[model samples]
Target: MVRKFYPEEFKADAVELYSSTPGATIKKIAADLGVHEGTLSAWLRAAGVTTVPTAAGRADGGGAGVPETPAEELERLRVENKRLRADKSLLETEREILRKAAKYFAGETTW
Candidate 1:
């Protein structure tokens, strides 16, 4: 005969296994929790946990240290520079159009 586990029981066991064996493999956790490995993998994925231990925060490409700050600042500045350049070019074109319109309405002839 097969036994059925309640939802709450399964959830509690999964959480317990996860916390108790922080670095355990998915297969290990599944075996320990008596659930399929795929089920455990889905649970972890749904919980936004990664198989890689340190891939959560340090996965931003900046391993560690204070050097990350300057890299982040440089990226910010590059984005800001691009935006400012676009705005400057647009303003220049608008100014030229306005100057031409003003001169045309001020008795200036282009013929």
Candidate 2:
């Protein structure tokens, strides 16, 4: 006789296990969970999680629900990166000004 596991519970556990411990072997996990490795893999696939051989923008192939062109993503990332960089610089300058003001009032270096 064989026992059946709930689909939702199995999928939830799979995601939790994978996220908590990355690079976990499917066979070991399946054995621990009392299911076949292939079954666990299928569950992961159906849960919209998959492992890709290459990083984003490097390979032509992408995971499900991703845009095709690397250039499109690259430009978007570049814009966001520039914006964040500018924001960081501005914050650093503001911090320096505050530090100088503190020092001036405390009778530190005048320059």
Model 1, residue 97: displacement in angstroms?
0.2
TM-scores for all predictions: 0.37, 0.39
- Best-fitting candidate, scored by lDDT: 2
State, as a TM-score between 0 and 1, how close model 1 is to the true structure: 0.37
For candidate 2, the C-alpha RMSD (Å) to the true structure equals 11.8
State how far residue 11 of model 2 sits from its true place (Å): 2.3
Off by over 4 Å in 2: 1-3, 52-111
lDDT of 1 by residue, 3-106 (tens): 54548667666855664543345666677667776677666666666553222223222244343356666654565577578789999999999999998888
Writing each residue's lDDT as its tens digit, candidate 2 over 1-111 gives 676666787679876785454334566567778777667777777777654222332221234455436776565566557757878999999999999999888896558
Q: Give the whole-model CA lDDT for all candidates, comma-separated.
A: 0.60, 0.62
